[model samples]
Target chain A: MRDWRYWLAEQRGTLIALAIFALMFTIYISNHPAGLTTNVAQTAANKGTLLALVAMAQTLVVITAGIDLSVGAILVLTNCIASMVVTGNAFETTLGVVFVLFVGALCGALNGLIVIYGRLQPIVATIGTGAIFFGIALILRPLPGGTVNETLADAMTGKVFGIVPASLLMLLAIVLVVWLPFCSSVIGRAAYAAGSSETAAYMSGMPIRRGKFAAYTLGGLLASIGGLFLTFFTYSGQASSATASTYTLLSIAAVVLGGVSLFGGRGSAIGAIFGAFAFRAIGDLMFVFDFDALWQPLFQGVILLLAVSIGALGLWRVRNRLEWFG
Target chain B: MSDTTMGRLSERMPRFIRRIEPPVAISFACIILLLLFGGLYSSAFLSADYLLQQLKVASFLGVIATGMMLVILLGQIDLSVPWVVAAGAMMACAATAYGPAATLAAVPIGILCGMLIGLINGIGVAYLRIPSMIVTLATNAVAQGLMVVYTGGFSPRDFATEEMRYLATGSLIPGVPNALIIWAIVGAGMVFVLTRTTFGRAVYGIGNRERAAYLSGVNTRRVVMIAFIAAGGLSAFGGVLLAGYASKAAQGMGDAYLLPAIAAVVLGGTSILGGRGSYLGTVAGVILITLLLSILSVLQMPEAGRQIIYGVVIIAMLLLYGRSPTNQ
Candidate 1:
């Protein structure tokens, strides 16, 4: 009833990302002494979930032909906020969580305002905002210590029904709530159009600016969501510049590995999530194999190079040299 | 604030000195204002020694930002600067551990290591047609990973050699530090290359439009590859200078320079989008940033406050002239 080729083409990036994750996860779990247990899966899922959320955030901006270097800072900022506010009683915790998410969205909205209305490049604007966000976080937690609601943190970090990782479930809920709705919305399609060709999108009278604004704002929100999760996982927050920068860099890598074109206008958040998982799996493979922790960075980097390089393999098939620019 | 005033200045200025674009002129003005601003706090801020100290420090960033400007001119970027810089300092220092011969050859060897990373970056961006951003990013991570593996998470025990130390800290010409001389040399070379050489023209050409440049038979790929390689080597050289200044290489030493280097480049009026900018603008930019950082520190601002100021200043400076908005 349906054209399988079209479906395959549409889902190619996601399928490839999923395959990569599955392959790497298999190798990782196989190498571990404990084999494939719920505990191991839960740990892996819990760790991978942070990067997945950030990568998802990056995906929205990338789809709009812009990059957000501030996502990590936003996450860190939200984490710091959550650490301070997400305490007291259950109602208080819930209120704090809402406040944190709001702050995240507010940060994203600021980024959107600067880029869309101030008419600045996204890269530099985000870099500026990133520094601001990190500074704010530093002010909030200068010494790297703050507390979140312990019960909430434990539950969020724990397994669901003694099997599935609760963090992963929350991540899925986010994808459903944040990404799917935005991906199918008029503004989201406008974002894709803008990314593919901004001039065309604008010429067609599409709401390109509004779409981009939504993307940047959503990107911030997602980063904050990731930040909240970080708070839950750690039960604390620290404004480490290293963490901010690392997450930002790795998120870009994850987006690329997820099959999103850095050139913009292509790919999905789910693909990015899988890409993040694959990246996490690649990093953890060293631990399972008993390699020194020192070797992890090099190992992760080499695997990332290989993964991103594979995408470049498609260029060789092009007959015209001009398409390389395209 | 307005291009109309800028147009008048260029029109009024002599053709020979026209390289000082409006943004560059504005940057120079900012430097003067910054000095005055600092003078209001402490008379020592305008003192020769203090100014000289700032100049010496700016030299390191000046050298590194030179490489970044080259890449930015090509409409690409090299995020690998930070780690490549560490690799340079680390490799140079590590080479000294191998006996006298390696010690003597350390500087070149360190730079060569960076160039090697640049080679991979160049190949990926050129032959493989990968986006410069992602490729440089991958190389940066790989460089960091390799460095970590080499050091095993500890700072290198090998101290910076006397040559590097002298180059960084010693003043051969009585008043000027060797680092300043090196920057002057590099800066002069950059100016000449950008204004006089065909390679420079090709960089601008490719950056403006890669396809058009390719069709014009400019060997666009080779030019891009060389730019990345040069950027890598220069970044490493900057790292070498930094190690010399500090007497040893520490883990993540390069991290501090990345943002400052980029900010300096953009502040100098070079378009982040590429194809337009000048060396003098960058020189003014380096000094401006150095003074700004100095004044901020002298004020005893907290790190977070300083960071906020730094970010704000960059955005404000860019807003002044770096207004090359993306497509409609």
Candidate 2:
């Protein structure tokens, strides 16, 4: 195969996710009462972007062959904090945003510390931290009422030039600023190398710990971004456990659908973004068809199962049955 | 005793102590320490009535943890547990309107519902080669949706039968809760299977390394399926008992149990990575957790604080025992 062919092979998962999202959105738009107008697109973009940011966060940690179960909790925690602090004057809101991002990084750092120094499995470690984060969230907004700066929330969530979504632009900017640089950096490659084979990476003198730590910290920052958007959209913070768990679960599904290998070392945040969009569409599709909201989980579950099962297709191609266990 | 005799005793103790798994020893110590703390908190804490109540509470967690242990032993996880528990309880409760015989059959039928879900989980993981985590999670969501559609997002109206209520809240022997008796019986059976059965041996082998187990003529797929099936059934059984305790099953009642079940298993010295652990350690863990939680409630700590404690305790325990020399 040519070099570009290999690139295509590498990008297959992301491409599939994009295609899936495009197809779903097309169907959604055509079936919609308002069609593909700015209002419809903006509404969809705003909802999808929240999940995309979190899915992007999950993508980073997953690239290091580690899963952060606390992403949604961090989102909730930051949302709660932002509700209290991201208010008052413009300067105060800016400071709140920065502070919320810092809090997220700190949470991610804590997870990395425990996983590395404590030598604990990432899954177990994150589960514990997730609970801790949710606990903090519950304390922050024991009641669901708090305000965000309407000026900021409106600008971010509103349409740009009445044609394109501001949220979509923001997501694009994040991809360029956060993901692209990380993808090309030495640390990012190291993270991938470690995920693929830690022993090899370590033996090659790669800074595996630093790489994974960066992935986790960046993951936290991204999730906080999701939280910020969530606060903007809802105009308040509610420490809803249902929302937290659902987001966490859906982000994983998005990551998988985006063609990011759960086994680690491959895939992209871009793919995950598309995966998130595609996943959100699954719910919207139900609405367009006038299906009851009760059917949403079932549809999401089936799609997730089918998408994940695609990853398992390789098992059939394995000549040795032993490889199936791997 | 002389100083020389004390020195000799100390010198010999490490060798004996080394034979006991660190998590097992630590959990037992925690149980004792917590009991001491409980006694200090109130005179009622040291009484048999209070302790027995604690045991009764622990039994619910114990049953769920037993299934969790089996899945973890196979180097897999079952996130489907929450909904499986719900499904069992909901279906069993729904079955109660038929007649007396149906009420008696409700328990088995509930477990069977869980078993069917487990079979699907098994097929996905074993035959399809999907990761257990994703497969089970997907199933959990599916189960949730199904239950929601069935119940129309409300609590199932059917109540637990007298039999179930008796099993959960009634005492089988004087001063002994029937729930505890049930847990003990289940624990005893699990211990026997782990220590003596070929199936047990296969589970350990697969956990240690599945490829090697497969090559060694162990029916790895079959074993994995059976383990998951058993886990599903047990979780359902726990839910049924919980329903009885509450007098009715509610949507999402099983949600709180998932993490606690995982915590109990890991705290009991069972490796989350699989292939290691003991039922005795789990018993200690269940008791310790229950006692700690009860005391936390007694302290009037808010729900948020209690959650924080649970999370912190799990991580702390992991740091103490989750590590192995080979992994690092």
Candidate 3:
């Protein structure tokens, strides 16, 4: 039907991302020492889930046409916070999780306030806040040693049944809980409008600032969720600048791979999720193919450049040079 | 403390006199405050040698930030700075294995690598129309990978050539560091370009509005390309000096420059959105940051405290003057 064609066009990026993930995963599993095993699936799912959450966070901000360089800082800070407070009994752990999420949302809100009211560019403002967050994280966890509630961590990271990964299920739950509602809400439309064209959005009386604020706030919340997962997976937290920079870079790469336009307002977190998975698959392929670990960064970089170039190919069709700015 | 008095005072200042911008003035004032504060810890903070030593260090950042300033003025960014810098250092060092005569070609070879990286960045941004941020970042990752593979490990084995060493650390003039003199020459060139040249005017015009600039017959794409290429090359040159200063290149050597360079450019009252900044502001910013770091160390602050203070100070400075209404 014509309606399905329109729907398919809208869903094209997500589908392509999914296809890429499927293809890479197929290659990875076929070459894996133990092919398609639950352990392998679980391991892959665990790693993919962390990036998926961060990439999903990035997707919200990118959708609003602003980049958050501080996502990695928020993740690192939350992880450090969780490591310290998410200890002892069940009540304490739950409290710690809530607190970490709160801190993340607060960080996002601060970034939004600075951008919206302070009238600063997102790039510099986020860089400053990122440094501040990282500093706090360093103070909180000067060394890499803390414990999460093992029973809860185990349940979260373990397989959901005899087959499916719990981390994957958690990712789905988050999508259902946070992203779906946000996507359907009027705020989401406002965000899309703002990203599409802020002046036009403003003229049309769309709630541009509020929409962006919500996007950034939710971005922080989602990044904190990723941080919690990292603490569970590693069983500790370290204020590692290397990890923070890596996550920030890879998350942006994943968002691009997921087909989210850096220009804004053109893709879904679902696409980003698949993109994160495909990205993880690239690294795993390196592991299986016996490529030296040193080659992974280069391999990933090449893939990222290729993906970005493919996205830019459509621009070649623009007849007017001015459209390049548009 | 009162607005009316300050307004009248500013209004009374003659246009030909070139009144100091509040942000730049405040930065200089902050530098003095840092020195005074450090002076309490040690008399050495006020001494000529200590000040010159700080100046020498600031020159490296000044050189890098000069390139950064040009790109920022054009309303674009080159995030590939880290690896471009690394690649430059490594290439210069790697050339030593070819023998002494080839060593003569090392600096040029290093800078050329940087320009090549810049060319790719420029093409992606100018022609392909990929966002500069994303393209530069991807190239950074690629450069990182290339550097990693080249060294075969965490650190490079080659030593800095004699020319590289002298250029970085040797004094061509009595009592003045060669690096400082190099920075001064580069700064003067930046001033001339940004103020005097058609290319420079095109960069400002494009930053203000690319569509309008194109309509006005400016080659917006070419200007953007050249700005990025210049940025990459300058960043690499900074790296070469760094490698030479240390007598060797190391892994992740450029990692430390990105934030500080950006911070210096902004603190000097350059609008992050683009097309507005003075070279003088950047100079003040560089000195301010260097002094701040020195004072923080003098105070025996930990890295965490230093970082926190650094971030807070930048935000405070920006908040003070960065909110001025646009020229329009």
Candidate 4:
């Protein structure tokens, strides 16, 4: 019980966000019992999984005090590349997926290299690269429509167990395989150190440049995974797949709300996952209420503001309490 | 010893060339490149009419860039410019509809609205002790939200009057645009303000060392507020001209300006981390960007290619300037 309490205390923000999610989910179920069925569950699972992948990518960069505005563009570019390469054959499709992921990593490495070697500010540099990536995506797939193999899409989106969605299974696998090691490793600690104080970290021999480069490269890799998942869910790759640039901002908000400081040096992969789920639940709740699309931007902005402020206040209070003890 | 002294003098000459080279030579190179492309691609590109049109388009961005430059000079930023521009245009359009008197009233109202937002940003940063980036970003969101609620994503119809049209499309000289003239006047005025005024000196001082300036009896907060207000007013002016040019304001029109304005400031040899800059450099930067766009248009490049190149050029410029420690 004591151990559990300590764990819960460490993740208070995530716990609170999860509690809100549960409340929202209960309301959603009460409003639309039909939406509680298998189909809706699977749909939510698929969409949430994809969004979580993108959020994870964003989280990696944000944890290092850098932001990758190019995520959406990279997603589009990867999706387009996948569409061009995958021609419905099972073997070909697998190859295409691998190719897309590789491309995504390559693109991310370019951004990381520029940031590290070129010594460009992350925001400005990424915005520029984002524009270039977006342009390339447009050139590759000039319009909205490319087909994905139905079988592959179905396999990814379908149930893996009696009731568990395949997407959930994929999410679990990814969490176990990629995130666990990455978050606990020396490299990750270096990322935290760099974010806290680059100059100090450099003085401490933390390999600051390498850490930033790795973070960005990882961000790109995660975004590509997101693109692949998005393709499976939609069963298509469109040029305008990532039209919502505001998603990047929302992802940042989610990270911050999950108790991740915008200044970086403090956050968790688990917290980011919870933040993603919380955001998804909020959107779902709004839909259940039948709010118009016009209200989306306003609602998102307000929620983001509220969430960030609450998180900041909570952190301040915690620090104040700790100071009292000292 | 004399030979060593002569060698050192020659070495310093190259260093001097390198120092003066970037702003003047780069802009000249870009202009020459644009002229070359224009000469080769299209006969119409060299005409005074084409040049004037490009100048007019450049003016809208130039005005905002000038204000942005001031904020940059103060070692801060205002991300709220986009929505402020939208709000300014919306307010102007709203005023224009009620009556001619109302339309005239909009000028001050637009300036005041911008000033109010700027003051809020300044207070948030200076007194409340918030980071400028986050504060301005939040204000941008609020402004954008308000703009959407008020305008409903459509251009307000009130700004279609003869006066508005004159402001947008009319020429002061037979071929030269009125907007270009306005841009020149604003640029000259700002240059004078920055160099001649005590407030300008204080801005540079504050940028150099806020703590030192504060100790030296400079009203740092007020100066910062004035800088933001000036930026806001300038952005509003850009918005007014944009409405005049298009005959209406649209959603996200201001978004496209964000990068270009910042780029112009950077390209003008202004440091992103602040402390050293010149209006002349910004003027050159604006011309370079405008010329680049004009050249791309003349080349008949696709929108995607143009966008890609735009980002690349800006990044390249930043990298080049950022590496030169002297700029810092």
Candidate 5:
């Protein structure tokens, strides 16, 4: 029983977030009366997939003790580029998608290079890049109206096997194939080591600069995936229409809520996925309650504060208790 | 050997120039560039009227930057500047609606609002041990929320009055902005506080090492609180002037100042990680950034081009003056 208690405490943030999600789902199910239908489950799963992808990307950067303020900008820019290239043909759409992801990677690489070689602070560097990237997106489209091929969008958003959503499958593949291996690799281990103590990492002969660059580059790749999902869900692209800036903050909040420390060095990609779901679920619940639009930003701000505080408090408690345990 | 020495000297010159902080150097370069362009293109750039007009515009940003400089020196940031400015302007305007008695009350109220918000931020960071970035970001959201809820996204017409306009638009020197005078006074005051007061030394001490400062019995919390309150007051004053200049308060007016204020602080050589900075550098940074914008406007560049230029300037400045690789 004591061992179970300790295990539960170790996973408190994830456990609490899950509880909140379940509670909200229950409320939603009771109110709607079409409780737990296949369609409803698929919709929830689809939404969760999109958020999970971005949250996972966010987790990589956060684990390095850096925040990517430009994630939303990258998404918007990629979406804009994709919209501009989509001529409503399937081939063009596929080509455009590839081009968009490439652009996203390039953007991320630029950020990484600047932070690594140019020696700019991550938050400040990202902020400047974000503004520039968003500006380029605006210049490309100027307005919020662009058509995407409806067929492709539907395929990506639709369910597969009558049980699993297509989005969920993509997300699972990313986790199983990409993130899982990366987390177990030497580069990934070095990232956490660097985050925990840069001086010590250096003393230990870890490639700190290269690790940071890789972390940021990976963040960019994840952001591109998020952009693709966003494009799929919206079925179009609008430069001014998307909520990209909000997502940057949301990604950070989700990562932090999922037990990723802002100070870095300790968190999991899986935890971040759960954090994203918790955040999205809260918003879904708020919509169900008919809260005014103006109140939403305020509510989000309040919740983010609470989540960060809890995370910080939990870590502080654990550190002190562990010292006593020792 | 002599030829080698000359080559070495030439290489070192560019490095030295780069080390001199990009904003300051760029401001000087841009001024000369603008002057040359104006001489070639328009007769107006060298005109006293144009110079005075530019100074007037710079003053609004300058006043807020002055207060922002102090906060930045302590290695914390205030994202709440824009809202504080708007609130101050609104308070001043709202007071005028109740006649003279209310207008008198409004000034203090504006200052008080700034101080109160700063106190909240200070408490959260110092006592609760929350990160300043998250605390200030949340406060900014709250302030913006309050503004939207209170004003319903529209400026109150009754808030603007003759008295408020005098503060915003009325110049001490004909053709110079009254805001310039206010900025100068505030700048001088900050110089005094930063240099003359024991409290100022404490700020530096705390910024350098919070633990050491605490051990030495410096009230680190109080210093942080004071810095935030001062920032709040300054931002509010800037807002009041903004309301006057525009003839009314507007939503998102404060949003534009966030990047510029922080940019100015950093440009002025204040370290973002806290500890070691200068008010004079911030003053120079403010003038330089303001001039860069004015020059862009004078060139009649498209908004997109101007934004690109702004981003490039920020990046270039950071590259030039950022902490060295060895230091990191």
Candidate 6:
């Protein structure tokens, strides 16, 4: 294959995810009662953006070929923290926002430390940390009642220029600011290299550990960003287990949908964003069509199964069956 | 000839000793330590009756962990457990409305449903070669959705049949909960299969290296399929017992079991990467975890604190004993 062809092949997953999201979203808007009005668009954008941020976080970790089961817990914890601190005066709210982000970064760093220095598997370590994060969140708000700065929440969640969603714009800005630099950096390449083949990356003297750590820490920050938005949208924080587990699972699905390989060294956060949007759209499609709410889980599951099965198509092309183990 | 055979056995002893055996010991040690701690906390905790009750409770977890161990042994996982468990319970309960005969068939029907799910998981994983994690997760979601639709998004109206209640709660022998007996029977059966049968050896062979096993003329795909189906069926059986214990089924009943089941399996010293572990270690793990949770509840710690403790303990155990030569 030519270089461009290889690049396209590498990007097929993301592009397909984008296409799916675009198609679903178009269908969703056209069938809706309001017909793509700002209110409806803003609502969808707000909901989708929350998952997008978390999925981006998941993408970063997954690109390193490690999973973070605690991302959702971090989201809940930060949401709870933000609800308490992201209130009162403007200066205080700014400080609170910074603090919330820092806490998330700290949580990620803790995970990184355990996985890297402690040398534990990512899945078990994160499951543990996820539990701890939830515990802390539960302590923060025993009862789900807290307020955020309404001004900030409204501004971030509301529409921009009476049409485009502000949250959507923020998502674009995050991609440009956070993902672009990370994608091009040497450490990012190191992460990809490590994920693709750790032994080879180690032999080549790549700073694989540093790269992975950065991915994990950055993943935590992104999850917190999602938490911030979640608080903004709900105007409160809830220490709900159902929400936490759902987001964690959904983020993994989105990461896969976005064309990011669970095996690592492949995919893009931008693709994951689209994947998240598409996943959310699938649920909304049910709503728009007036399907019984009970069928939503079943519908989502079938679509996810089919979507994941598509990735398995490459297995048939494997000449050596042993490669399946890899 | 006898001397040479003895020498050969001695030569292999170290390798056998080194083969991830210490974690099982460590798990037992932890159980003892936990018991001591519990005893210190409350007099009731030290009572034989209380301890027996703990064992009975642990039995439920043990059954689920047993199935989890099989899949993990094959170097695979089944994330569909939670909903499969709930589905088994709900379906079995729903069957009871058909009267006595249906009530008698409830458990078998529930297990069959689980087996069907396992078959699908097996096909996806062994045949289609999709990752088990994704496939089972999707299955879980589908099962949950179906159950929700069946129940109309409310608590299930059907109750557990008389047989289920007897199996879950009744004591056939003094101080022996029927649940414990059922678990013991399942455990014994599993031990026999794992140790005595060609199928047992195949599970280990495949877990160690599927390609190698296939090359050696083992039906690797069939083995994988069987393992997954067994896992699904066992998980569903656990669900049935849980419904019996509760005398009813409720939404999300299986949700809480998934993590703990995995934790128990891992804590028992089974490698999450697969192809290495023991039923004995898992048994210890279940008991240890049950005690930990029981004590945490006795301490009146809030749910959040309990979760934190659970997570921390799991990580600690992994670090303490899960690391073996194979992990690297």
Please give the CA lDDT of all the candidate structures: 0.89, 0.89, 0.87, 0.75, 0.74, 0.88
Write model 6 residue lDDT over B20-94, tens digit each, in one string. Answer: 466786788888898888878777878989988999999988888889999988988898999999988889998
> Interface root mean square deviation for model 3, in Å?
2.5
TM-score of chain B of 5: 0.86
Model 2 chain A scores worst on lDDT over the 10 consecutive residues at A314-323
Ranking under DockQ, best-scoring first?
2, 1, 6, 3, 5, 4
Chain B only, TM-score of each candidate:
0.95, 0.93, 0.93, 0.88, 0.86, 0.91
Q: Per-residue lDDT for B1-328 in model 3, tens only?
A: 2346666777877874337766677678878888888888899999999999999989988988998888888878878888898899889998887877778998888888998999999999898988878888889989988887777765544688888889899998999999999999999999999999999898888877788888999888888998888888898999899999999888789987887888898889887767878898899999988888877777788888877876787677667656635322
In model 3, which regions exceed 4 Å deviation? Answer: B1-8, B14-19, B153-156, B323-328
lDDT of 6 by residue, A14-77 (tens): 9999999999999999999889877998899999999999999999999988889899999999
For model 6, the DockQ equals 0.63
A1-326 per-residue lDDT for model 2 (tens digits): 46999999899999999999999989999999888888888899999999999999999999988888888899999999989999989889889999999998898889888887788888889989999999999998999989999999999999889889999999999999999999899899999998999989998999898899899999999999999999999999989888888888899999998999999999999999999999998779999999988878878888877888888788868997777887
- On the 0 to 100 scale, the lDDT of residue B282 in model 4 is 88
Model 1 alpha-carbon drift over 4 Å, by segment: B9-19, B153-156, B325-327
Candidate 2 interface RMSD, angstroms, 1 decimal: 1.5
Model 5 per-residue lDDT tens digits across residues B5-99 = 54555566767664554445555565567667766777787788887777778778988887787776676777678678777777666666666
Candidate 4 lDDT tens digits, A100-210: 889898889989888777877677788789888878887887877787877877888898765889988888888898777887777877887888887788788887777
Candidate with more favorable, higher lDDT: 2 or 6 = 2
Question: Taking the tens digit of each residue's C-alpha lDDT, what string does model 1 give over B1-328?
Answer: 4778767777878887665677788789988998898898889998999989999999999999999999989888788888999999999999887889999998999899999999999999988888777788789889999998888865555589999999999999999999999999999999999989999999998878889998988998899989988999999999999999999998779987887888888988888878888888889888988988888888887889877877887788777766775545
Query: For each model in turn, which proportion of the native inter-chain contacts is also found?
Result: 0.64, 0.68, 0.61, 0.35, 0.34, 0.74
lDDT of 5 by residue, A96-122 (tens): 878887888888888889887887777
iRMS values for every prediction: 1.9, 1.5, 2.5, 5.8, 4.7, 2.1
TM agreement with the true structure for every prediction = 0.96, 0.96, 0.96, 0.88, 0.89, 0.94
For the predicted complex of model 5, DockQ is 0.36
Model 3, residue B93: C-alpha shift (Å): 1.2
Instruction: List pairs with backbone clashes in candidate 6.
Output: none
